[model samples]
Target: MISSSRCTHLLLLLPLMFSFFVMGFVDLVGIASNYAKADYQLTDTTANFLPSLVFFGFLLFSVPTSILMNKIGRKRTLLLSLCVTMAALLLPVFNKSFAGMLAAFSLLGIGNTLMQTSVTPLLSTVVSDDELSSALTFGQFVKAIASFLAPLIAAWGVHYNVFGMNWRILFVAYMLIAVLAVMVLSATPFSDEKPADTSGLRSTFALMRRPMVCGCFIGILCHVGIDVGINATAPRIFQEYEGLSLTHAGRITSFYFICRTVGCLLGTFFLSRVSNRRFFVLSVVCIMCGLIGFAGFRSETALYLCVALIGLGNSNVFSITLTQALQSCPEYKNEVSGLMIMGLFGGTIFPLAMSMTSDGIGSQLGAVAVMLVAAAYLLFFAFKIQGKR
Candidate 1:
């Protein structure tokens, strides 16, 4: 049986896990919203604003919240983040204005940025090393679950006719998960100790200069961009290019995430046998091939294979990146983690940039091009590390 202390700490994982529900919706629809925006009589540029707005909040809020955790400790930061996460998800229920949804996404981004930075350190405080990757990968499993489930959520709302639209009901359920997460974290026994002395703004960069740290940070940015890239584009590729309805397309999208969750589960076992550095390199190669496959072909079966491959290939990235970043600075765990998540500012803006570029180029294939760029960097990082080793 798990100890009561361990149980209490693990309970906190629920809120962090659930925040992805709001995040998944925002992440998955980066490209799909082109359809929604057009349906609602909006410009492609205006539609692309949702993703940029979300990450903008991440950029603005990540460091301050990380410092707050240092001074006040994990639990309070978590509660505040969880509440914001819930509010962010629920805002669309009452207000459907494009600008309002953008505001909500911004709040959600800030909430997620805090959760992303704090919860891993919080989990590290709780779980043993044997279970560390397990817990982290399990979070990925839940994240994939949220991503996979989100499209169905959008579909269900369509079937039932909520908010004169479909995806709004999806946000309703995401808000409920956020509430449940908050309740669990409130009851958990996480510590209130300061995380780090992040009071000085100059410290953020001073903290960033450790060898391999920037690579690790940039690695996360690229990986998130890649992960978000697939989630963002998979639906449209499956629906428009593959010719499926919202529901059927959603089911196929779910398969990609299911494969991702499985990859992480499998990664926990393999980490004992393989080095993370090697795994990340191979995963990037596999993802490169997957995206290139999508670019090369139009067959539905092939699309499913490629999408699942994309998730399976890169599922280990976040854990691998975080582990390396922290391992590089064993003492400065929370600060490093904060800087790493703050790097996710790229995930938000990159997708929106891709969308706008697609507008000018007259093809969403610009999404694929954005992905190849990320993969190229991954390959370069992998090579750079190999040269050093």
Candidate 2:
């Protein structure tokens, strides 16, 4: 009977976890930006704006989505996000104009922002406190599966001439999955805890005053900044050093995500037994090494090694940081989740800084330097977590 109940619990959790895969749809912006660059003949700085647009929604919608979850409930909020994402994916299918692509990506960002704000908190409700970090890490592993697939699927679309739609057909494939996620999650019943206190922008901002909260917020900022930075910059490194075409350079991007997927899969078990602080410190060191190697090394093999290190190091930072914050202040999970998701605005800030620097220096190494600074900040954040849960 106990095993039966556990199986039932696992069955229900499956669909919620699938939503993490849907959340990964936002990462399509990286490859999509490259496609846009080729098609529009835009400069690197201008092409970079596409990713900036996708993440900009995090700045505008994360906090509000948190507040909305309080009123409507997490599962319902997730469904809303899925619907928005479906709409976003459909737009580019019919029209490939720059304006149409921008509109589609904007909606993609908004939906992903809402999904990020609500989905993890919803997962937290399902699992016990002790399991939160591991569960979230596993969720990240699932998300990385989708991330790693984006470029491959786009490349496949171009190769097979599927639907005569080019890489935009990736959107069509994901739209169908989004519809399935909506249906499954809607039918699965989740008990949402009512808000005990009214939360708004003021209260959410007030969390920054707490040293721990502030540190975690900055930790998330650096983690996401690095994640987006690597996603946007890795391909360029291959292109510059090896003279690989965009299609082949994309394999390096997939390699980074593959390492991340494996790292998160391992982290799901290790985090449950190892102290979060110890593991986090180790991960930060790995990222710093990767950053230094990426900045200094010009050889193809060396650069690939560095990319793998960074991916492995970064895989669990978000899950670890977020779970620690929620555990410390269990009362304000919604607000904390909102603030953490807002830290994803680092996605916007880091890529823009990298773009500007890469343009000025006339080398991809300039962009790597920006990530080095982000990595240094993560090193500091790791120290602060030494004795923390």
Candidate 3:
């Protein structure tokens, strides 16, 4: 058994840091898309497409990777993910050509999506159950930190001409982070406890068939749509209509992450005290109100507040939903967890849908309005929550 003191080592944070690095790079793919557009003189539709392709990786890998994790075990699963991440990071070095770069982005997307799915479940294993909420929140808090610093990292890469040939210097950074994650996983000891019959494909499918699994799956799916849609749309609303600098708009975006970090902390503090149902239901209402506030008006200050509010709405959705999903089917937490992460594909589908809609209408705000409709739909699920025994 892995001892608590061993788990307390900073190495525990290595996964968080590496996960953050992967997440930061993935989220910041937008910067690469923008840079590629200018350098290559690509069309608007094509340029706008880069991030969505990366998002598609999230859709594709969430479930399959988790099943892989279940069969192969978490440590090896993570190693496999990191290897792909390394390869993806090197894409720009070899293929600065448009097709090459898009392929690279897609590779990066698949690699990172798998990394995220594995890391979250991996973290859940290392920490004590009482501290689960706190550990998860801290992981997210660190993730917010990564999301926080990504732009700055990208800006420095551009400022100094780090890549020199293509904007692939960022990939070097990603590679370094992956190496560190690998080192951390090697050094640290985590519970290798995995669900039963994991190697059998039939058992995995059987795990998914449970109603509890289905509910958590949908809950995670809807929540991802709610969260990703808000993040994607808020920046656009500020940049296009509110007339904020893209950099300034990012600050507002940071506020959403900040609110999410806060919500995670709050959830950690009260996880034992408050019922998940109450929290999930209330958060859904808050998210809708925040999105509606964004849609209803075009105020800058108001927009920032709403974005933060939306963050508040979603701050605990991941934790609450994951917990609920596990609670619903404790007999198969790993399978259920994998199933839950698959729901994260909503990140890909919802944002892409919003972006395509906005492009069709020639308005960024219209994209946000589409998300408002999504948030409203989520309220229905939030109403159905019942804390499992």
Evaluated against the true structure, the overall lDDT of model 1 is 0.72
Higher-TM-score candidate of 1 and 2 = 2
Model 1 spans with C-alpha error above 4 angstroms: 1-35, 162-165, 195-199, 243-252, 384-389
RMSD after CA superposition, every candidate: 2.9, 1.3, 3.4
Q: Which ten residues in a row have the lowest lDDT in candidate 2?
A: 380-389
In TM-score terms, candidate 1 sits at 0.89
Score each candidate by Cα lDDT.
0.72, 0.88, 0.69
Per residue, candidate 3 scores C-alpha lDDT tens digits across 1-389 of 86877758456667655665556556556556656766788744566577667767876676677678877788777777777877887877777788888888788778777777777677767666666666766666666665545555555666577747434576777678777877766776667777665534456567678776776677777777766565555665787776765545545555676677787777777666777777777788888877778667777878777777788778777777677676667666666666676677776666677777877889876666777776666677666667531
**lDDT per residue (tens digit) for residues 286-322 in model 1:** 8998888877888998988888778888888777777
Among residues 3 or more apart in sequence or in different chains, the pairs in candidate 2 whose N, CA or C atoms overlap within 3 Å are none
* Number of the candidate with higher lDDT, 1 or 3: 1
Give the clashing residue pairs of candidate 3, or none.
Answer: none
**TM-score on alpha carbons, each prediction:** 0.89, 0.97, 0.85
lDDT of 2 by residue, 1-389 (tens): 56987987897789888899999888888888887899999888888888888889998999999999989999899999999999999999988899998899889999999999999888877888777777787889999999999999998888887989888889999999999999899888888877888798888889889988889988888898899888878898889888988888877778999999999988887876788889998898999999899777889999999999999999999988887777767888899888889888888888989999999989988888899899898888887774544
